[model samples]
Target: MLFFILTTIGKFLTKDEERDRELMARIKARDSSALSELYDNYNRLLFGLILSVLKKREEAEDILQEVFTKIWENAEKFDLEKGTVYTWIVTLARNKSIDRLRSKVYKEQKKQSTSLNDDDVFHPLYSNESDPLENTILSERAERVHKALNEISEKQRKVL
Candidate 1:
């Protein structure tokens, strides 16, 4: 009886993994409906996890959206040998939230630095005023950088 119950549970888990794999395959094909289905299946659980990490509903919501956007973008990179779909997504949410927290701390430190003595302040060569010509050049440079990054393999990009 114990062997039969354990085998049945294993089969159920395998079926669940197979379903998640199929959803990921469809997402990689640019199927919006498949993404929607994935969101429907995982959003509540992911949201709870994000909310637990951030403790702010608004920021948690934003992170949840970012997590799904990442899922959509990186669907092709999923590997069964690495882990299940659930594990991958939960890791993404946790990492994103931690990043957001770190960014908030960095921004706070920057704000504090602005209050330092004039002699301690580090001045930049450039002004903050917007210039159309400079803006265009910066935009083009950003696009080039983005394209260059996309040309590299995901593993290499992650290492960078």
Candidate 2:
């Protein structure tokens, strides 16, 4: 009984690549701390990889946030037997960033407003008489989300 207890405690205390694998398993099982460790381990490298392609800081930052959001939301879909955690995350970041890049360009083109003298004209979404309360509510919501974001750990905050 004594030997069994000691071995159990010893195994619990050990930290290695296998521990990382276990953490990933926990993350797959819906543990949030494992998601934090996953972010701390790969955020910078993945961000740099995205920044290389996106070139714009804000766009890259948005892509980084989106990549990790998808990772945490989809952690259960990962299979350690198929690839290393690093490879899996990096691949996810790369794919998401590329998709963002493509869609961003499409959105920009769609939103372009031409001068009145030209064939196109800008038609605003809201008229000059639009309610100010709507704008105030949107601004307040943005501030609340920003404050809530600050409450999270730096590891999780980096991607955001």
Candidate 3:
């Protein structure tokens, strides 16, 4: 009994890569201190990886938190045979940063693909008009729409 207790206690007190894997196993058992320890150990390296990929301090900071949260959530799925804890964490940070970068790029591409006249969609149709003239033009446009709607068949109206 004494030897078994000593071995059990010794397993919980370790350092380096072996310690990290043990922490992950403890985290999978919902031990908060192990999660905190893992974060304390790897946060800097992961943050640097994220920053290099994103090239923005704020975005990198956010991604680092996201990566850790992902690790915490997925702790139960961690496989020691696959890789070291650092490799798993680094991969998470890199993948998340790359995903965020891709999203920002996609949004920028969408903006670029938009027509240059896109602003006109929201600009006053009669920016130069007096109040009365603007109202009149709006009324005319509304009337035209009403007329066009009336001219359409019920099926066409429903489709529109």
Using lDDT as the measure, the top candidate is 1
Write the residue-wise lDDT of candidate 1 on 10-51 in tens digits. Answer: 334445877888999999999999899889877876787667
- Clash count in backbone of candidate 3: 0
lDDT score for residue 147 of model 1: 83
Which consecutive 10 residues in model 2 have the weakest lDDT in total?
Answer: 117-126
- What local lDDT does model 2 show for residue 23? 73
Error of 2 at 53 (Å): 1.1
Scored by Cα lDDT, where does model 2 land?
0.63
Candidate 2 lDDT over 1-160, as tens digits, reads 3223322332343335476677778887889888888777667767776786578889888888888888878888887655445546666776776677666655665677422321121222224564332333345457777888989999988987
Compared with the true structure, what per-residue lDDT tens digits does model 3 show for residues 1-160? 3223322332333236788888998999999899899888778767766776678999999999898889889998888755557556765776787688767765765788964343443232224434432233355457777788999999999999
lDDT of each: 0.71, 0.63, 0.68
What TM-score, over all chains together, does every model reach?
0.61, 0.55, 0.61
Off by over 4 Å in 3: 1-15, 114-160
Sorted on lDDT, best first, the list reads 1, 3, 2
